[model samples]
Target: MIAIVTVLLAFPLGFFLHNRTSAYVVYVAIFGYSFTFQTLYLLRAWVGGDHSAFSADPEKLPLDYLAVTGAIYAVGFLLITLGHRLGAKRRNRSLAVDLESSK
Candidate 1:
């Protein structure tokens, strides 16, 4: 539940700040924190006391949560990289045109 929400929020926030590289760095840091926290939560649930109450067996633990988090991070990072590249290209083209016009 909380993990899902964190992923949802991180993606858009990352995408929105993609124009700047600094924002992408921050996004990755946040994603890392969320991933570590969620992983710890799963480990605690599986290995801590009352584990059987949380899951009938160790194999039943929700490993897919980690996979989902990785996928979201990959997608968000890709989007931010693409956005930065596109922005840089546009800025370069505009500068080129301005230089040509001056010449």
Candidate 2:
């Protein structure tokens, strides 16, 4: 259920920013969500007397999940940055041609 919601969010997060200039927004958001979950998980576990981090308390604080999320975020940033650069190059080329023809 959490995965489903995260996946749904990733699309717009991947799509909307569309450049390295704004890439930090997504990265920050990604880390923020992870931190928020971790904080809540720790609070709940502490309050319930679930001390051991390695214990099977079902809080789902696995390292692999963080790795996967970071990987996805990096790939998304690269793709979006590439798209922005390509679009900018194409636009500049067209504008240059227009300027040359006008001169």
Candidate 3:
């Protein structure tokens, strides 16, 4: 659910609003939220006195949670980067056309 929302909503909004302050906030939230949740998962067992978060056994790692969070982070970045590239191209083309017409 969180991943879906992040991809469908947060990512595109972040992309289109890149120049605005809200976009930076959204970027931080989406990316940070992912890692935070994953971190919580890794540390869940620690609260039970099982072991420290850092020294937890590799076999007990929250692989699925990490994968989902990572996927969300990657998707958000990819979408934002793609939008920026496309927007830049469009802006450049428009500027070039405007310059030619003014001559």
Candidate 4:
């Protein structure tokens, strides 16, 4: 669910910003971290064994889930950054050409 939303937003965000750095900051850092934290919070709640749907009282907090989320977020950031850089370079090149021709 969250993954679908994140993937759907990534391209439009990149296109809307049309700036590599800005896109990365907005999409990867901001949105990515937001979703990650939200998931963690939900997981914590469920782990507390209060939720009827997913009740589980563990002896310790799930550090492994934290590690997995961290790794997934890192990978997502890397992939998004790479794609942003490539798209930005192409768009910038075209803009430069247009500007050069206009002058």
Candidate 5:
């Protein structure tokens, strides 16, 4: 659910804004929110003496969480890049057509 919302929002911002920076801004905002939420959840579970977050191995969970977070960040970046590229291509094509028509 969160992933879907993030992708939908980010892609449109990238596409409609037609700015590379906007994609990154969206990426940073999404990544920050997700990282903070996960960290808070882990901290809460740890403080509550719930080791379920750690599963059977206490030492491995942090690494797993980091890996998953990295994957999410990477995917978000790829989506934003794709949107930005497509938007730029469209903008350029339209600009070229307008120029030709003007001439």
Candidate 6:
């Protein structure tokens, strides 16, 4: 569901941005956390049990889910930044070689 849509969007963005590896890594991280959170949410909804002592109410959602989502978003942004830096480095090296040849 949510994981599927996230992958679909990430894949094309990766290709278009020429950062497939970073994109895939971020995608995996995002999907992994999202799935885990969703599972916990579902369990809390159905099982009516609180596995963690932090929450008094079994029906209450965990605050960690929000933290996980934020972490994923940060990872994705970092990946994009790294990918752009790598691509720029490669481009610069190629340009330097071309310039030297013309000298």
Best by TM-score: 5
lDDT agreement of model 3 with the native: 0.62
Q: After superposition, how far is residue 78 of candidate 4 from its true place, in Å?
A: 1.7
Better of 1 and 6 by TM-score: 1
Q: What is the lDDT of residue 84 in candidate 2?
A: 57
Write candidate 2's Cα lDDT for 3-102 as tens digits: 4434545444445544645655665576567657865786587668776543455566767646765676565556555555665665556443343655
Worst 10 residues of 5 by lDDT: 94-103
**49-68: candidate 3 lDDT, tens digit per residue:** 66643545556766665676
Off by over 4 Å in 4: 11-16, 28-37, 40-55, 92-103
Clashing pairs in 4: none
Q: How many backbone overlaps does candidate 3 show?
A: 0
Ranking by TM-score: 5, 4, 3, 1, 6, 2
Q: Where does candidate 6 stray beyond 4 Å? A: 1-16, 19-61, 95-103
Q: Encode model 6's per-residue lDDT on 1-103: one tens digit a residue.
A: 4435453555344544655665667676767777677766866755666554235665676678567555655555554555556666665675433445553
Clashes of each: 0, 0, 0, 0, 0, 0
Q: Which of candidates 1 and 6 is the stronger one according to lDDT?
A: 1
Against the true structure, candidate 1 has what lDDT? 0.61
Q: Name the candidate that leads on lDDT.
A: 5
Q: What is the lDDT of residue 91 in candidate 5?
A: 84
Question: What are the runs in model 1 whose C-alpha is more than 4 Å off?
Answer: 1-24, 35-59, 95-103
- Report lDDT (Cα) of residue 57, candidate 6: 65
How well does candidate 6 score on lDDT at residue 27? 70
**TM-score per candidate:** 0.48, 0.42, 0.50, 0.52, 0.67, 0.43
Instruction: Name the lDDT value of residue 15 in candidate 1.
Output: 46
Q: Quantify all predictions' global Cα lDDT against the true fold.
A: 0.61, 0.56, 0.62, 0.62, 0.70, 0.58
